[model samples]
Target: MSRAAFYDQIETTLDQMRETGLWKPERLITSPQGARVQVDGAGEVLNFCANNYLGLADHPALVAAGTEAMGEYGYGMASVRFICGTLDAHRTLERAIADFLHTEDSITFAACFDANGAVFEPLLGADDAIVSDSLNHASIIDGVRLCKARRYRYETRNLADLDRQVAAARKERPGQVLIVTDGVFSMDGFVADLGPICEVADRYDALVMVDDCHATGFIGPGGRGTPALHGVEDRVDIVTSTLGKALGGGMGGFVAARQPLIDLLRQRARPYLFSNALAPALVGGAIEGLRLIAEGDDLRNRLEANAARFRSAMTDAGFTLTGEGHPIIPVMLGDADLAGRFAVRLLAEGVYATAFSFPVVPNGTARIRTQMNADHTDADLDVAVAAFTKVGQELGVVS
Candidate 1:
């Protein structure tokens, strides 16, 4: 095809997306990430779509630490870690992450997507097998595709299906069998059944990897993540998580595992070896973020209360909601166009929430995924509930 033909084809796809209400528009935020933010066109609105679960995105301590680190180490690493990029603060952040996750060691990456991409290829060969949850994140799916490992898939969060898949995998007598899942599925807010997943792994002598990008820094005891929440910290073999969410709401990711596994990743993980080292400022902020998370029981409690309050109020107001006992609560709208319209109405009502449609969630299971954070107060919850109820009624999603 000619270049102009290719461009026309892309334009056709874009037009189709707009006609079908699948075109997601990006909003401009004019302030730091928090429960309330100044948006360019919408003015200041209550933000319920952020991953800043612990409300530490703009915390004073993290800012101070980042500033101090910038003064000491300058801004960027300018090189990969094995070259001239490894800073002492980088080592400190890695150790802090390993300690937080209760792992032997950890290695950093530019993003959790990179961390997940770096994981499978270096460890699993063509003779090995990877049994992944059907609902695992796209990062995991892409990572699996990058590796030459034999692939098996189980139904989402179904231990019985996992057992069957693992048994099938063992029939191949592969060199290794690795089971992978997301600690929390983002669109539906469903937490994975990790305890049972660990059991299946043990039964088959398979290694287990969890992408805890959504759960780290807020889901488990002391915000250690799904493994600690399920009491499977020692059972799970590998954990990949992000700093862009609850951990200071900055950018970086890491893999926490056994010392030898980390050592091997350092040498062979393509993303880590090829990507720039995480900035010293982010590392210092993450180090402080870990410290705050460790002593953040009160923050966790408030976050739970806010989520519960919002979930209960919304349900009582005649709205369907998904997930339980976690900050992520999806207000189910079913139709993609309706979901998009609901979000637009919510924004106009002073609530900032986004719609999850096909490609993010199943076609008929579209929703506005609302997330609660420690920074949101009862008043904020009340305002959000009121906004949702108003929009819900206007859209006939509720009585």
Candidate 2:
């Protein structure tokens, strides 16, 4: 096709997206990620949309660590790890992560997205089967698509469905059966029932893998993640998480698993072998973030308290929420347009949150996915509660 024709086709698709209310527009933020930020034209707003659960995104310690690493390791690596890009800092951070997760070893990736993308293809083959939760992250879904493994998907957090899927996959006589799930379902903030899942995996002699991107920093004791929360840290075989969320809010991801798995990924993972190495700043900052998480419970306590307070207030105010005791609190609105208007009203009231509708979430389950952080003060939370209440009352969502 001609270039003009190609351009016209793309423009028509974009127009269709806009008309369908599916196009997502970026909201420009002028300040660093934290409890409150300066949104362009919106001025300062309490940010409840970010994944900064532990609030270390703009922590002074992480800033110092990054700056120090910049001076010590210089800037970019300019090459992949196999090609002279492996720094001592990278190894240090990987080791720190492995120790944190109680895994044999770990391998770093440019982002959790890359880690998830490169994982399955290197490990599972066409004869193998991967049984995954239907609501697993998009990255996991995409990664599974790229792999040659026979895929079996079960309903979200449905153990019975998982058992059925596993039994069905076993009928294929695959070499390996892997049960994969998100440690924390991002949209609804529901922590996966890892213990039961682990039991089910053991029944089928299948290895369990958890993508703990949303739960890595503060979901469990010492912030060791969902496995730790469920007391199945030793049962889970592989864990993939990101430094971009609770850990420094920088850009880096890692896969922590048995030494053999890590070794294989090092040798064969395409994204790791082909992509540029994570920059020194992120590695250094992540190391410090891990240290902070390992050494103390103060931040975790504060974060839990904030989440509890917010969840209680929203519930008491008659807003229906999904999920258990996780920082991600989804205020269920049922209707997509109402959810969008709710978020807009929230922003107008100086609270910044985002609405998740169809495609991102199931249709009719539209919600405002608000996240809590340690840095959010009681006053900030009160302001947010007031804003939610005002909007909920105005929209007749709450009596």
RMSD of each: 0.9, 0.9
Estimate the lDDT of model 2.
0.94
For 156-268, candidate 2 gives per-residue lDDT tens digits of 99999999999988889558999999999999989999999999999999999999999998988889999999999999999999999999899988999999999999999
User: Which whole-number lDDT from 0 to 100 does residue 59 have in model 1?
Assistant: 98
Poorest 10 consecutive residues by lDDT, candidate 2: 17-26
lDDT of each: 0.92, 0.94
Q: Candidate 1 has what TM-score?
A: 0.98
Q: Give the per-residue lDDT digits (tens) of candidate 1, residues 1-399.
A: 999999999999999999988788889999999999998889999999999998999999999999999999998989999999999889989999999999999999999999999999999998899999999888899999999999999999888989999999988955899999999988788899899888888998999999999999888888889999999999999999999999988999899999999999999999998889999889999999999889859888889889989989998999999987788999998998899889988999999999999988887999999999899999999999999998888889889
Which residue runs of candidate 2 sit more than 4 Å off their true CA positions? none
Error in Å for residue 37 of model 1: 0.8
* Model 1: pairs clashing at backbone N, Cα or C within 3 Å: none
